[model samples]
Target chain A: MADAVIAAIPPGRHARLIVPRLLQRGEDFTARLLIQHPMETGFRRDDTGKVLPANVIENVVLLFNDELVFRGRVLNALSANPSLSVQLTAQKSGTLSAHWRDQMGNVGSISTEVRVAGA
Target chain B: MPKHAQRRTLLGAVAAAPWWWAAFVGTASAQSSTAGSDALDERVRAAVLVRGGLSLDIPVIVETGTSVPIVLFADPSQLRPGVRVTRLGIIAPKNPRPVALDMELGALMSQARIATNIRLGASQSVTGVALLSDGTVWQQSIAVVLTGSACYDGT
Candidate 1:
């Protein structure tokens, strides 16, 4: 049964963080994040018509320089492997972290180091 | 100004802030009623009553698919002083489940602008609501005409 659940999710980069490697100080840049998950709503039935338990990512948090920049509580309506895009302004170089927590308590995180163009 | 009068004036201003805000943006609050209306309207009214001052950025017409991007945001730049948005919700009434998304904003993340994709079950209104830290609410909505319905999982 555990293997079946694991099989539902593909193996690859379960999480991806997209941020500009270099940016001008005080400039706003777009940061996008993609996480690979089945986002199973638990309402779908298996091949035998048995209902699968709901398992969806419920929490997402983004941090820059250890500061909470974004937090989201996602619902099942989001498509599988959800992607989030938001605007963020940084005045200094720092690390951006993307963290995801699913309903099953599974956690994943990714971080990227960013630098200011001339700073 | 006498000290007692100054204190009274300050208290008066503090007491009137929330009411003033609710009255200033009257549209959402005025239309907010979760009575014996239909399922969709009830959800919209409930969301609106929860909070207001939210806006949905999406096209009026959309091609239904597994992924239809929608943007919901609250601009704190023009907000009244001391107004802080603490939570946001995205409601798609026509879907099998109405609440598409709900977000909690931290102190440093009070200003929210989220870009996410939603699956529309049918042509319907998508609603967004923002709950202020001071117990005030604001809401915004957008109607999308879907050409087709997305596949549901029997939810």
Candidate 2:
């Protein structure tokens, strides 16, 4: 079931991350992450009445400078094209990255530079 | 019996029924909905939950349950020195799987907050549970009414 879902996704961008280009040290800011996927609940049926296998993202992890910041488990109950926003503090300049895996075992990751001034 | 006395008796009966109160009264009364999920129950049982240190932000009424946005925020003042929130969970009582989202936080997080969208199968109460590093759990619940369902298979 997982293999079929992975095959359905088109080749291209699978995720996007939005972070401020610049930040002040010791300041808190919101980082938004959006993933492109159907997030199928497996409870829905196709036009011909076939049950859609659950193909939602299973886990998400956010990291800063190689340090884990936030991790989450995604379930079928989340809406399709899932978007997550988390609050993070700027302690120093580093790299902010996000990685996620779907129930189908497909992995997607994206990273951005976090520039903090006066660190 | 007199007409006024009969009316009073009917009102009293409605107020006296436990189920009626659970259905109408909001907040704590709607906790019974959490019973549908064993994961939620086990977490609640394992922690020391204090009602109201967290706040849930979601509309009281929504036209569709397809993508209802919600935000969970924990009071920073409630945390003692050297203690921080380490985990968070979101539970929708009426969904096929009541446990919607589970998250773990690390030290880099300046605030105990998160925003996301979720699917709701019906108009029901949603609960947010946060676990702190000091073994304290803060919980908050909000009721949401959906005019249309989101998870119906047949559509």
Candidate 3:
């Protein structure tokens, strides 16, 4: 329920999953994930000279057809609008979904379908 | 010899052996246990302190305020069977917070290669660490010299 609530909150930035709409069975594919966030390191101060609290995506999880596939833990070192490229082998066509949670408990997710071509 | 006599002879031989031999075995086991703990300590330090690993795929030379690209790779076939590479992390030791990026590798993923962009606050080495499900950690670090610095005030 907490995750659902977090997911339901309006996303503060644009997040996109870039994948081919279709793929050939057994084809090796690369998927790119893009999420727009400041990746605040808490080291910077505001215009008023107050240190900003650190806020960053603590972890990210990716699932293919409800099976855990990829997971990542990120730190403040990532530049603004962090993106990741990952390789996958397409054994079967299915939905690839990604979920990420920030230090502040904000959650964001995106999904795309990959149609596997018949031999 | 009778079976009972043979058992008594074996016991007598063990009791007659020098105490130093027993000490040697004890010492060997103790040394092994220490080595295991030392390895675990190293892993904890690497994961937490961003200390060491394999090799980083970034230019040795760089400039400030630019998006630096980095890649980490490992042969999937070399990984232990049924063990998935679950986590990848990047850190710049000199930064305010050294950690840059960390991601999870999806299931049935073979290649352990990852690429991403990062910003440098100063000239420093960026460390990348890969974590496998089998508790194995692989790391690599590359040093990059930045000509300037990126100024930022949290807006």
Higher-TM-score candidate of 2 and 3:
2
RMSD of each: 11.4, 8.4, 13.8
Tens digits of per-residue lDDT, candidate 1, B7-41, equal 99888765543322322233233334543335434
The best candidate in terms of DockQ: 2
Candidate 1 has which clashing residue pairs, if any? A42-A54, B51-B137, B51-B138, B52-B137, B52-B138, B52-B139, B53-B138, B53-B139
- Predict model 2's lDDT versus the native: 0.78
Which residue segments of model 3 deviate by more than 4 Å? A1-12, B1-55, B77-84, B133-136, B150-155
Candidate 3 per-residue lDDT, tens place, B19-48, comes to 222222232234346556555444443332
Q: Candidate 3 i-RMS (Å)?
A: 6.1
DockQ of each: 0.28, 0.41, 0.37
Fill in the DockQ of model 3.
0.37
Candidate 3 residue-wise lDDT at B135: 61
For candidate 1, the docking band is acceptable
TM-score of each candidate's B chain against the true B chain: 0.62, 0.69, 0.60
DockQ of 1: 0.28
Where does candidate 1 chain B have its weakest 10-residue lDDT segment?
A: B18-27
